[model samples]
Target chain A: MADSFSLMQEQYAKILQTYLQEKNEIGLYHAQQFSKKVLENQISPEEVVSLHLDAIEKFFPDLPQGARDSFEFLLEVMMGYGMAYREHQSLRDKQKELETEINVAANMQQTFLPKEIPSVDSLDVGVISVPASKMSGDYYHFVKDENNCIGVAIADIIGKGVPAALCMSMIKYAMDSLPEQRLQPGALLENLNRVVEQNVASNMFITMMYGSYDPRVHHFYYSGAGHEPGFYYNYKTDSFEELYAKGLVLGITRDTTFREYHKKVEPGDFIVLLSDGVTECRTDEGFIEREELTRFIHQYKHLPAQEIVNNVFYQLEKLQGFQLRDDFSLIILRRKV
Target chain B: MSVQSNVEVRTEWGIVSARQAGRNLAKEIGFSSVDQARITTAISELARNIYLYAEKGEIIIEAVEEIHSTGVKHGIKITAKDKGPGIKNIRQVMEDGFTTSGGLGAGLPGVKRLMDEFDIDSVAGEGTEITTIKWNS
Candidate 1:
C-alpha cells in the first residue's frame, strides 16, 4: 500500500513539473487525470489536495501560511483550465476535418477537366489550362461528333473554389448528355445556357465560347456567350482577325439568343480561344490589352500550334512574375492541310 | 542579339524539354557528342530538382560568349530558378553522399563535375537559382 502511494505521489510531481515547464494544455490534462485517478483509488479530495501540497511543501520547507493558502487556491483553478483545454482540442480536430474535406473536393474537381485533346483530322489542337488555386473557375471541354467534326468549349465560372468546381462538373455532364448538339454552335450554346439558367444559382453566371470545325470543308462555326473574343490568324495574308458574336452570359437570361459566326479556314490558318483570365493578365501598368495577345499570335505564327500555345502562356505567366491571380486557359486550333 | 529558350520546369514534361533545349543549344554551339551528353544530363538534374523540391520553376538556355585572357570562348549557359523553400545548408547539400530526398544524394555534385562552370544562389524563405555552363573546346 505504501509503495503504490509513493508511486502516485511521484506521478503527481511529474505532472506539476510538466505544467510548470511547458504550460501547455496536454500537461494540464495529465494533472486533471492524475487527480481523478487519486480520487478513484479511495483517497478523499481533501486528502489528494493535501498530498500535492505536501509534495510542494517538501521543496519549500520554510514556506509561509499565506503562500500555502494561495497555492491551494491555484489547485482549484487548474480544474477549470483542464476543461477549457478539452474544448480547444475538439475545435482543433474539427478544423483538421474541414481541411481534409476541402482537399478531397479539389481532387474531384480535377477529374472534370479533359484528360486529353482528341486527334482531329487535318487540324492541330493545343490547350493550356492553369488554375490560380487548388480549384479552378475556368473550364475547357472537347467532343468529337459523328461527322468527325471536333467541338470545343471554353468557359469561365463567375467565382472560385468549390462553388465554381461544382458548376463546372454540372456543365461537363450537361454537355455530355447532348453530344448531337455539338454540330451547331448556336443550338449548343442555347441548350447549355438553358441548363445553366435552370440549375445553377441565380447569382452565379458563366461566360463561354463554343465552336465546331469540319475539316473536310474547312469550315468553322462558332458562338459566344459574353466570352472574350478569340483571334483568327490568316497565314497567307500574315494578318490576325478577331471572331466576335453577340450574346449574354449564361444563367443571366433564359430568352438570350447567341449569334453563330462562320469562317472558311484556309491551310495554315489558326483560331485562338482564351478566357478573360488570359486577356486580363495584370502588368505593372495595368491589364494587358487584347491587341498585345493577338500580336503575340501573329509573331509566333510560324511555330507548331502546340509550341505557340506554350510560348504565349510562358510569356503571359512571366509578365505576371509567374504567379497567376486568376484561372487562365487558352486553346489553339490550326488547319493543317 | 541573343537567342534563348525557356521551359517551365513543372513536371516530367518540363524536364524533358529542358534537357532537349540544352542538348540542342550545345549542338548549335559545336560541342562534341560527349559534351552534349554531359550538358544535357546536368540540365536534367537541375530541372528535376526544381520539380521535386520546388513545385515549379523556369529553365533558361542562353548562348554565352566569354572573352577570357586565353581567347574568346563560346559556350552555352543554362539557368534554373524557382521560388521555393531554399536550401538551408547549401554546402552540405552539395556533398556527394548527403541527401534529403532519399534518392542517390548525387544530383548536385554530379552536376558540378559535369559542367565547366556551376553556380547556385539560394535564400531561405525566398528561392533558389542554379546556373551551369558548358564551353566549346
Candidate 2:
C-alpha cells in the first residue's frame, strides 16, 4: 500500500508541475490519466485532495494559509463521502451473494415438483404452474395407486423466497411418507395438518386442496384446508358450482378436521382447481371476475383438457398485460369413460 | 416540527431508500423498535406498489405533529404518488388474499394494518395517491 501511494504521489506531482507550467490540454490529459490510476489503487477523493495540496506546497512555499485551509475543508467533506462510498460497495457485494444463493434454492425447489403428470386411463388431466418469481410459494403433487385412482394435491404457502421453498420440500416428503392417506382426501389433509403444525412456524400457514378420483365409482372425493374453492361443472345442468369444503389452514392448530366432499363425474363434465393467481387475476381496469373465468373455461371446454388449461392461461396472462403478479397454478380433470 | 425526505420510486434501490428513510424518521420521532419496523414495512409495500404498477413514482416521508384536545401527538406521514394506471377497484384490492403480483396477497390490506391511518385516491387513467400515518403511542 505504501509503495503504491508513493508511486502515485510522484506521478501526481509531475502532472501538477506540467499542468501549472504549460496550462494546456496535454497537461490536463495527463492529470486525467493520473486520476484513473488513483481510482484503480482505490485511493479516496480526500486522499487525492491531500496529495494535490502537498504538490502545491512543494511548488510554492509562500502559498497563502487561507487558500490551503479551504482545501483542508474540502478534504473533510470528501472524507465523509468516501466512507459512504466504501460502505455502499460492500453492501452491493453482499446483495450479489444473496441473489446467487436464492437461485440455488430455486433450482432445488424445481426438483421437488412432479417430474411428469401421472397418466390415468379413466381420467384426462391437465396441470400448469408458473411462479411469479424464481422461488415459488405454490406446489402440487400427483400419486397414482394400483387401482388407478389418481390423487392430486395443490398447496400455497403464505410466504415467499427461500423459506417458502424449504417448506414446500418438507411437505413433498411428508406426503410421500403417507402413501396410505392419499386415497382418502379428508384423512390426508388431517395428517398433513398435524405434520405442518408440528414442524412449521406458528406465523406461517398453508392452504391446500387434495382430491382422489375413483374410476370405478366415477366419484371425485376432495378435501380442503382453507384453500380457494374450485369449480364443478355439471354437464347435465350446463352450469358451474363452487366446490366448498370446511376446514382451517394447515399449521394453525394441532388437530384440525377437514370435511371431505364428493361429486359424481359424468362424461363431458370436469372439475377445475387453481390458486388465487387465476381467480384473482387483475388488469388495468380491475380483477377478472369469477364469472368471466367460467366463461373463458366454457369457451375452451370442448378442447382437450391440456389445451383448455393452456388457452385459459394465455387468455388470463394477456388480460393481466402479460405480467403475472402471483404464482399461477391450475388443474383440470375430466372423466373419459 | 416537520422534517421531510423524498425518494424516487423507479427501481428496487428506490424501495430500499424509501424504507431506510422511513425507519430513520420513525426512530427520530421516538417510535419503539416495533413501530419502526412497521413503518418501514409499510413504506416498502407502498414503494413497491409504485415501482411494480407505475414503473416510476415518488415516496415522501415526513415527521409531523398533531394537536389534539388531550395533547400534542408526534407521528410520521408517508405519501406514495404515481401517474401510472390507477386502481379500478379499491374495495376489492383492500380485501385480504387479493394480489395480482405472485405475493402473499397482503398488499394494500397489509399496509393498512401496519399504519394507524390510511387513505387512498385513484382514478382509472389519471393516477393514484396513497397517504398513511402512524402516531407514536
Tens-digit lDDT string for candidate 1 (A236-307)? 998888878678999888978888899999999999999888998998989999888887777777888888
Can you give the DockQ of every candidate in the order shown?
Answer: 0.01, 0.01
In terms of DockQ, the best-performing candidate is 2
**Model 1 clashing residue pairs (backbone):** none
State candidate 1's DockQ: 0.01
The window of 10 residues in a row where model 2 chain B has the poorest summed lDDT is B97-106
- Report iRMS values in order: 29.8, 16.1
Q: Give the TM-score of candidate 2.
A: 0.59
lDDT of each: 0.82, 0.84
RMSD of each: 29.2, 19.1
Poorest 10 consecutive residues by lDDT, candidate 2 chain A: A79-88
